[model samples]
Target: MSFEFVGKFLPYFNDGLIITLMISACVVLIGTLLGTLIALAKLSKIHVLRWLANIYIEIFRGTPMLVQIMIGFQLLGKIPLPEFQLGILTEDLSRLVPGIIVLSMNSGAYVAEIVRGGINAVPKGQTEAAYSLGIRPTATMFKVILPQAIRNILPALGNEFVTIIKDSSLLATIGVMELYNGAQTTSSTTYQSLSPWLLVAVYYFVVTFITSRLINLLEKKLGKGYTK
Candidate 1:
């Protein structure tokens, strides 16, 4: 409601926005990579690998992210890490590192399921054909199966990216200075609680909305060749 107040703190929000995007980008890349490996492990013939992957996925997916962030912060904070600056962002590796790690781990669990489902959706004959040509199982999975599986799961992966953007707010609890923390700081300083939050909500909506539209466009472009 207070446009003037919101305008005054826009730069602070922008800074927080940068951190949020950075965290989400790291989580998406790391989570997807970790998830894909977990998915492959889950689909492996090795019983020990399947069991370990199942346990990892279950533990991360079953727990709350906030708790994970808090615990990870405490545990990882013990390790000594040097702080550095990245332009507008001051890298507090103690908090930022744990926040990104916990988020990536949590995200990896859900992405693992998405990837597993995508792999399952692929036709079995594809693998059979690859194997018939004397392709090793690993080669068949990497070369023949994962590409198709990734295509099938693009929308789901996009959703995961959006989710990470929103969920990055949790990092604020441990003082990582993300968007929500910026709002909180503004509210504490300006003595207007609702306006800062409202403005932050708009910021979140704009980012997520634009991201969703971009993902949709990418999906369409990717699907064009398959369309009749």
Candidate 2:
């Protein structure tokens, strides 16, 4: 394997890689926050809220993320959405925003289910005890139920984050041009015997491995107090 192309291709993708990392981070953070909300809604005592959350989970999880990205950024932008005029977002936000939105929407579905499972795994007595102690329903959820639920679901959440990291490659299809895009461009320009592709693969592997390790630590910490 000729290693000379490393110097040639790496610089070209350096900026793009930064953008990719930024995009992935945004997707994870935004997705997790939104997902937690949806999860709570799905587990709500109100049937209406549960139904709404279920439908949302079904639609996003059932749809292809690629289709979502294309429709969200290109088609929807052309059609002019009318709900909110949040003013123009930034250059980075343009491609990255839609990508993040689509991914967060998609990931939220699975996350909701994971969170629900975590909630179920929590001892039912805990909720009852919170109620007996005069904790409001909302307070019980935020302070007692959800916190424990989140601890249980940390592993699943990490797995989803890893999935999102890999799935971020889909953004390139819409011209977001992330790490994979940078690799493609470099490979085409240099005709560089697969080195660029290999490098991109290595980068993903390392990042994912580190993420998995961190998640492992979280799971261990949670496991100390919980069963799953």
Candidate 3:
């Protein structure tokens, strides 16, 4: 509200914003990779692969991400995990891993659909031409189809990245200390709930706004190359 409150609170919010960005970056990278594989499975000629992919995509895409996170986080404690030699990844890291996994799994389902649509958008003739030239199916898909498909879907993927940023706040429920959690901490400590939540909301808006603009510019650039 007031400039003084803004000055006092911005630093705490910035710290949380950084963590949110870091988590989103990790989620997007892992999610996009996993999603692409799932999409490929969905498109594969193999029946079992397609069925498994469908199951994964359906379960993840159908469930709420928050529920997914809570389930994963709770299950983590019950499972026996191997200790890491690095020791850097201790209890806190253990807590974070589940949240990241949940986010990636959730995002992958949506990204799979985007990727499949993008792959389908490529003309049939292109695949036929690649086959005619003796390109193996895998090679054709990886070398030709995927590249073009990614270009078509880049904007959607960027939007996914933005969405992940906002969704990362959900990790706070499990104590990830992301933007929302940071605000919650501030509110509890300062006893001024409105100011902290307001600041974090502004932070989310700024991050998403900037990200959307960059995505738009990238879409335009990629479009220029593909125009007939």
Candidate 4:
């Protein structure tokens, strides 16, 4: 409610926002790459691969992300990793690395399903046509199938990115200093609980809203040349 209060802490929030974006970006990159591989594994002819992928998807999807982050923090702490600075972010690799890994694994489970559904939605005839043209299965999947599947899943991927932006807040529990953590810091410093949280809520809404609109535009552009 106090514009002055909000203005005073804007820099703190901005710093947190930068960390939030960094975490989200890293998670999206790792998750999408991991998820694509999992999706392919799930669709593979090898039962062992499919089974392992299913188990992975199930375990991650079935658990709370908060729990996963906690577990990751504990487990990854045992590994001795060299710490380094990355711009404005923390130099402590322990929290940062584990938080990103946990979130990426969690995101990958959901993204795998999204990608699998998208791939499944593609007409079976496309694969058959590729096969008839003497294209190998790998070529058909990578060259023909995945391109169409990615187009179909673009909107869903956009939603996932937005989800990551919001979900990155969970890293605050591990002291990664993202938006939610920023809100906590501001709240404690200003001794105004409601306003700090409210500001971050507004920040989240703005970021997610703009992201969604950009995704909608992208979907429209991509949908232009293709039918269905």
Candidate that scores best on lDDT: 1
TM-score winner between candidates 2 and 4 = 4
Best by TM-score: 1
Model 2 superposed RMSD (Cα):
4.8
Give per-residue CA lDDT, model 3, range 18-123, as digits (tens).
Answer: 7778789899999999999999999999999999999999999888889999999998845555433211111256667788999999999999999999999999
lDDT of each residue in 1-228, candidate 1, tens digit only: 565775677877898898899899999999999999999899889999999999999999888999999999999977787776644446577888999999999999999999999999999999999999999998998999988887799999999999999999999888887789889988999888688999899999999999999999988887877732
Backbone clashes for every candidate come to 0, 0, 0, 0
lDDT of 3: 0.84
- Candidate 4's C-alpha runs over 4 A off are 1-3, 78-91
- Residue-level lDDT of model 4, residues 48-159, one tens digit each, is 9999999999999999999999999999966776665444445366788999999999999999999999999999999999999999999999999999998889989999
List the candidate numbers ranked by lDDT, top first.
1, 4, 3, 2
Q: What does the lDDT come to for candidate 1?
A: 0.89
TM-score of 3: 0.90
Whole-model Cα lDDT of every candidate shown, in order: 0.89, 0.79, 0.84, 0.88
Error of 4 at 92 (Å): 2.6
Stretches of candidate 2 off by over 4 Å are 76-92, 225-228
- Please list all clashing residue pairs in model 4, or write none if there are none: none
